[model samples]
Target: MPPCQSSQSFALDAIDSLVRCGVLITEENPEAAPVCDFWKKKGSLKWTTTDDPYHSDSDCEEQDLCSYKISQPSRCPDMLFFLCSMLAGHLRTLCWATMALDLMNTPLAEAEFVRQIHSHLWNTANQKKQYYESCSEEAAHTAVRTLIDLGVLLEERQTGGVFLGVSPLFQLSENRQKLHYFITQYLYS
Candidate 1:
């Protein structure tokens, strides 16, 4: 599979973690079939069978389930979009991404890398520039360290601060496709 597939899986995994942790729940039916006794009649808490639309169903038992209410219907998509936006911001900050386009496999200088990233953030897409830069310089540094940890980037020996592209997945030709795939996987998977 393409490296982007992995990236997509990573994105999906992150989102799934939120869902699994109960930070977000499906809007349509938070409790399709009561999985706990909280929703049904208890010592002082009395709930009629009519309280649940699924309670009377012959094929299903809705009692003994938690009828938790979830207010946000757009949470899944909204969170996914936010996740992508944040990732795009971080990727744009990683100027070494250009090395992905260099067929010659040239390493980018650290100073040049920062300069290029600044130019991209300061000039391109004026509306988002500020928001993109909201990520602290320290955060960018941490992101770079993460890339290196993930084997996506390589540290140069000649220039201690310089970095080289070690993975082709970041190439311009594959960047968008990878990002799209990542988002799609996160939304569907």
Candidate 2:
């Protein structure tokens, strides 16, 4: 939920987003059963019976319903969407996420985020100071505005330029949890 510290550190990769979101488990776990009849419906996720070797210690031996590690194998693009949804769902618990993605297929909305990335491509050192100086608040405003429109980032003030926080579920990824803590416990606390 913490504002991307700087553009360089921000990742727009959706696959990375999935990995960050932890493709291990999600609310839709129950929907992936093989004989459950519900998921067997057309357009439902194609899931086959599986025996997960990676169920955590928290798993129940008796009706261990989470055999998802098999249905949605790792390194697949289709799994990214599901994982992203789950991560997005978890993030919603804390706050709406306003990510500045550097997407491979799509474009980033914020000019400042993009420009900052360009600066990184040109010069990696002192990137933060340079980005702040060269980047425009207007771009951040535009990006934030677009995100609010897309439901990715929510605006704290409709007339101003202060961004709140991203979803806390993003913390399931690498530094996301610490970033959330930094925002809630330190920065905004």
Best by lDDT: 1
Looking at candidate 1, what is the lDDT of residue 66? 31
Worst 10 residues of 2 by lDDT: 96-105
Which stretches in model 1 have alpha-carbon errors above 4 Å?
1-105, 125-143, 159-162, 180-189
Residues 1-189 of candidate 2 have per-residue lDDT tens digits of 348443212321322343345553422455444322222343322222224445332343444333323234455747645554544423322221222332211223334433543343324224433323223344334444544433333334334444343322232343343434332331111
> In terms of TM-score, how similar is model 2 to the real structure?
0.21
lDDT of each: 0.43, 0.35
TM-score of each model, in listed order: 0.37, 0.21
1-189 in candidate 1: lDDT tens per residue? Answer: 456565534543544455555554533333343322222333323222232334322334333433333223453546645664656555554432333233334367655544444444444436543554524555445554655654455667573666655444444445534433433343321
Query: Which residues of candidate 2, in runs, are more than 4 Å off?
Result: 1-134, 156-163, 168-171, 174-189
Please list the Cα RMSD from the true structure of every candidate, rounded to 1 decimal place.
16.4, 16.4
How far residue 6's Cα lies from its native spot in candidate 1, in Å, is 20
